[model samples]
Target: MARALQACLDGEVDEVTAQRVAVHGEGCRRCGVEITVYREIKNSLARQEVPDEAAMARLRAFGADLLTTGPAEAGDEAARLGGT
Candidate 1:
């Protein structure tokens, strides 16, 4: 499950895989802890600052694109919520 979660963070797994992980994590305490750790680590990485204003603007634009186009999983309605 940890490997599967890593695959999710690496974009190697599809949304279906992540959803499976989520379900398992909900029932299993160990997997739930691991998923929480994964999310915290990912969030920490995302908090790192870019070197310049231009780079920040580019990130903002990229996020806007996601907002407009939606998430990676097509036809998955829950995936559309909260800009996941």
Candidate 2:
């Protein structure tokens, strides 16, 4: 049976298992593409830097307030939350 490909990608597999998957990927075009694509996506995400954690939290809180309170008090909440 094939080992879990996602496990390999996530580095959850041991070295021997990883080597096996790497070999399999080499012979199989589709598997190779999937591995390459996920690796690139993970690498790209690693390079990105989020600027403001606090602002994101505030926006999330504002969204939650909108859901519970609706538009009626949204303006006041937005004003208080510093949301435009």
TM-score of each: 0.52, 0.54
Query: How does model 1 score by TM-score?
Result: 0.52
* Stretches of candidate 1 exceeding 4 Å from the true structure: 51-84
- Candidate 2, 1-84: lDDT as tens digits: 234778898899999999988898899988898888888998877765555677889999988988998976867888999877
The lDDT of model 2 is: 0.83
Per-residue CA lDDT of model 1 for 1-84, tens digit only, reads: 578878876678888987888898889999888888988888767766544668789999988887877755444666566446
Cα lDDT of candidate 1 equals 0.77
Residue 20's lDDT in candidate 2: 88
lDDT of each structure? 0.77, 0.83
Model 1: which ten-residue window has the lowest total lDDT? 71-80
Candidate topping lDDT: 2
